[model samples]
Target: MTQSCVARVTAAYRRIAEADRPEVWITLRPEADVLAEATALDARLAAGEPLPLAGVLVAVKDNIDVAGLPTTAACPAFAYTPEADAPAVRRLLDAGAVVLGKTNLDQFATGLVGTRSPYGPVRNALRPEKISGGSSSGSAVAVALGIADIALGTDTAGSGRVPAALNGIVGIKPTLGLVPTTGVVPAARSYDAVTVFARTLTEAQRAVGVMTGPDDGDPRSRAWPDDVRLAAPSRPRIAVPREEDLAPLSDGGRAAFAAAVKQVEAAGATTAVVDVSPLLLAARLLYDGALVAERYAAVGEFIAGDPSAADPTVAGIILGAAGLPAHALAADQERLDRYRAMARRALSGYDALLLPTTTGHPDIAEVLADPVAVNSRLGTYTNFVNLLDMAAVAVPAGEADGSPFGVSVVTRAFEDQPALDIAALLTGEQAPEPLPGCGVDLAVFGAHLSGQPLNHQLTDSGARYAGEVTTTAAYRLTALGTTPPKPGLVRVGPGGGAPIGGERWTLSPAALGHFIAALPAPMSLGRVELAEGRWVLGFQCDPDSAAGGTDITEHGGWRAYLEAAGEAATG
Candidate 1:
């Protein structure tokens, strides 16, 4: 894998040079410099370094700083060179990913349509005549064009997700502040989130995992919450919009969403219709109400200094918010709190909420003819997300009106894994693992596996199934004579052991403690080694307590052992 970084970087530069899509990039690094970095990464990997993103080529949206590259945010006069990388970029680099260049975006990230850029509109990757959603327009197109393995974008008003939806790629808009936005030009500082775009949901989720953490530079950065679910429930309760709420969808778009809903059901999820009025009302507040004042607060003075330096529509929107009364801002806060509460109640028991990433895919000419109305409509399903402090994963569903149609799976703040899990299910891609260090990963080998009687103990404690695994040959499995038959995994000092099959489960920190505390004697949590990677918290037995237990190692797993004894499925 390390040997391939040079070839991958070479291919990316060639693709960039050959695409003839000048508008997609604002400042590309010299091919030689990028190649040299890739070469260094190859060397590091060969030297026994662990690089999760080794050879992964990344594109940074122009609004986010990439050391040595100018961050234009598609506004030439506002461009500046940063001495260091943004927290997001730094993390990716540390994980062995190399930056390709700075991709274009709407001027100051103010519009949903990609046309607001002074660098020239970023045309859709699939069909040039259509609008590429913004303000992270070029980054999405870059990823779609295969010029980058992972692209970074910012989503304030669906800029990140909308573009990905248009380009038929995976877009990850994490829960607010999950990836610190320090060194990024803020559209709405409090609402802005650095998002990831990749061709596959698995790749997109991996990139997101690399960027998840807290940063001192960003005051809004948050430590991963201990209560968030690391994975979705097996039979998830998915929330869908009321039929009337989808009135904004055109015929093709509506049909595509219906098909997408079918995909969700096929994934073993049960859907429930819910009223989204309060959320929609709050979404309007992003721009139509006092929340727009944050835009003015971000760069209103800069636009004021040289109005001609910014895009007319972007300038107009920012300027309009400049004179709002302070009271309106205060009142809007109270109103938003109420709407959040209502929206929360509406989504109480759901694991994920689904919505079209946008109402429809519009043509560039059509949006150019009527920019504001079309842009607002594009944000119909998206503008409420950040305001309500939620996470959403947007992925291609199918096609609508000859353009790719996509849906956003929304989850409560920090519950991003469930959103990605459902997206993976819809796309038939590999489901993501638990976020590293975010939750406790426990390995179970007995009656607690899926489809077994005692599995509810983990589920009841809010644990989620991470994935299946096989323990190393160093461990042995024994039949523990408990009320509900269980398997005791023991680490034998040497050669007389066999591989054991088990499942890994993720639990919140609080839940793990409670779960372990409730475990019966001889079933304590201990370090159990897997076939690969490091040891994890797993079920183990006191060797002394297992002296009289029947050895079940020859059966390969507890389930297999029980099957031979005609007892595994009895529970």
Candidate 2:
């Protein structure tokens, strides 16, 4: 609004014209109408109206209806001009975002590779020769190329996530049914979700936030649970897929994923390599098992009526499900339920699961020559999400060789905020905000910091890393001569100690009780005042316990003291 909303729209249109990527959009909104809307937006701003999205330009994947625009979903023969916008689109528009147009995608959102669309392939924004991951291909490319601030897409498999990874942007696929899909053409009905794309995690999150709410018209839309944890763990126990699970990863992908693992650890996360075969096994069910019949249920009639009008690859995949026996689908559902339980047990105490978004990025020719295999391989790390009823946020971690590489932070359903926060933490693009009220937050200046000797006690107790914080300048740190060596924290009455750095973690009440019951003499739990003027449960040593201990306050925190001690020992 500051630069004139109309001017922003005009500039975006100019960029789109210069880019000349027709396949990216099946129906570009008339420039005059967009400018008029922007002008109205500017007047609203001038009238002192508050707008959260405020002039944000958006592109909608064609499968999601936009009033006055044809919902082709990249197949012209099935096009329909809707009189009203999809709920997701209307939400963004209501929040002051202006729609650029309806973008192309894999016909009926059936394929991962962008090439399945009859509108023509939506080329990768980075290297035109590379395939833009889809079926949300054009929407992702639009954001990556700076043509739009945000884009709406649909994800049944990896449509939302894969395209964002390939194009180097952020994609947030919320908990299924969290964002209404009422006006969106069904991909797989039960599994499909509306996703938002943006250049940064915050923007994508902001867009998704505005779009989240109940949709009475869409039975899939569910209310976010009132008891869900609001903060991403400041120090989380992350589950990493075993190396074998990544066997299809190219050398460059492996190297990049390794670096991504290190980045998360640096952000205060502790990771354990675990077998994720159950999740992988479940992923195969999407296309390789009876569950794919959902796609058949979605549009089998349209494809059956005129297979010639659909992308043969999409038509073939969806049609294959048409003949699946009803009992077969029922049996697979039972199997999927078992996998879900197994996945939960495997991820029992972890805050999130981190994985490469895809095995690798392929060139357009490679995908064109072998569409199915390439598409399947790309989904190796992505397909099980919706099936498992989880939420995820995909962000760029760095690059693999010369190709852009990214990772997804996957968390249980309704934990969208944490998934997004973890993705933000990895990229160092945004800081996570604390959302208390669900679990007990404990501030630990010593033993329980990630990687510290006694940290396992907290992890074993199901503690989640809340974040790093410092005590108000009224606490002292002391080195206690205990077995395994622990730090003692003591509060000096007033103005007598330094502000001591520490890390915070959240644990269940029962876990906290057990954690305290096992604490040996000299160590105690009490309220500790933070620099932010808030008090949280924390470790505080009895003043007598520190009477004979060596003062380590100058070292700041336990980790720093340990590092200094290690350096001294090495020297």
Candidate 3:
């Protein structure tokens, strides 16, 4: 009642309804439910409780199961009461997040255009006549409208990212197995992933960290590597698709993408134009190849059982799936595997691949006129990600014609941290204030570490450099072989060690991705204990990669070593 964040947001929701209500949500939480959750969150905060997502209200795409809610997946006949929350939903709840209600999506998660839903197309939050990209339509609009801090969505193709791009929000689709897909209605199980949408990368990442991790029940869930730490490279190498590959982009989208590249370069990165045809081809296979059958497999029986209950558009798509022959499916699977290998090989040389989130933004009417064709076009860049086992984070670059423009940072699986880091850089969303009462401290070194060549990398990754800090005198510094000149400080022992240098930068997991991707070879990230007995993410040298590097521990820090080298040369 004292105007809590949740209350203010709820009130705003009502006001928007009174003004010019767009069909953003298919179903909303009852007033009683909203008030109860808000009261509980307020009490928890007042009691000084440890809540990771204190006062954060999140919306769930209707396709995802929320306990005590009906999951229609845009098809009312398919609606069912989920007695238990999905794995991802349960995690958010455990983190003290309040669920507002379920939002509209493309029926059965079959289309990228939000209009396919029987409940009514979700109009773009910025412009009501425009389509809100889907199948994560309502989730994106909810976040963009400030009705929720973050929203849960499913991205098989561009469901998660497309909506975010159209609505001007951050959409993060982690590695294929990074976030479990349990409890969400599957569109294409193998390609399906639970995604996060939020107004800020910081908020989005906070939700991701709380939701991610291997679940025993989910066969696809895998353990995260222990060595993986969210730290940026001294100089990141990002690959941009060649102009020819982006031919499908409208003039405005192309210009926005170019501007985003400039931003990445301005942040002290090297951008190399590369051909992305192979990736594009793989994306095409999602609908063209046997993968369509997978979509049918998920709900083919349900649709057949109750034809009247399904959305017409959804029925047509799934019906097409039924006709896919076994031989064709087999051939398609083989081709997909081949393409996946090629993608891995092509992406190995770059930290991450950057591309526009969508080639074009169609209005709701345009999408409705030709749903399948327009929806397929939207997924041109996104469909291949999960198939290739890649992680991606979509960040707002700028606006095009009053609509939002966004770029996706893609990397090989497990490199999710770096991709998010790079996205933060492009979006210029670094240094966000921490949630109230959260004591997590971040230490940055290198470009994002503070006062270094690529320092913007840190700020862009949403990291606030706490200050300079020294290692516990147990570290050795080496100038690893890198293009922009990088130093790796390794903790060797507890005694007889030098005061190895670095900065203390605190950031959420999403910010950490941008930082990690900027890391140059020979140097990698690791956990280093600070002199104050605090453990923070820091850099380490791949011992093998540092074999012939210079010992710069005598200089105490990377900056000092570089300065001394420059002076020696001048002399």
Please tell me which model should have the higher TM-score, number 1 or number 2.
1
Over 1-571, each residue of candidate 3 has an lDDT whose tens digit, in order, gives: 2457467557756855764545667677776777777788878878888887766888999888899999888887778999989989999988888887898888888888888877788888888888888888988988888777799999989888988888889998987777788788889988889999998888888898888777876788765653343444546789999989998888888899999999989998889988789999999888887789998899999998887877777888787889888999889889988998888777676788999998788887787788788888899899999888888889887887678888899887766777777787876767233321122355544444466676776555534446688878887877766666677666678885687667776665545665478666666777788888878767777666656887778888877887888999999
| Cα-lDDT of candidate 2 | 0.88
Error of 3 at 343 (Å): 1.5
TM-score of each: 0.92, 0.79, 0.80
Question: Considering every candidate listed, which one attains the maximal lDDT?
Answer: 1
- Residue 453 accuracy (lDDT) in model 3: 70
**How do the residues 440-512 of candidate 2 rate in per-residue lDDT, one tens digit apiece?**
7889888778878888777655456767999988999999999888899999956789889989987666667
Where is the poorest 10-residue window by lDDT in model 2? 430-439
lDDT of 1: 0.89
Task: Give Cα distance to truth, residue 208, candidate 3, Å.
Answer: 0.5
Q: Rank the candidates by TM-score, best first.
A: 1, 3, 2
Show how many residue pairs clash in every candidate, following the order shown: 0, 3, 25
**lDDT score, candidate 3, position 570:** 100
What stretches of model 3 exceed 4 Å from their correct place? Answer: 1-22, 431-467, 470-571
The digit string of per-residue lDDT tens for model 1 on 420-518 reads 888887889878776546677899999899988999878765577767999888888888778888888889965669989999988898878777778
Clashing pairs in 2: 234-465, 234-466, 235-465
lDDT of each: 0.89, 0.88, 0.79
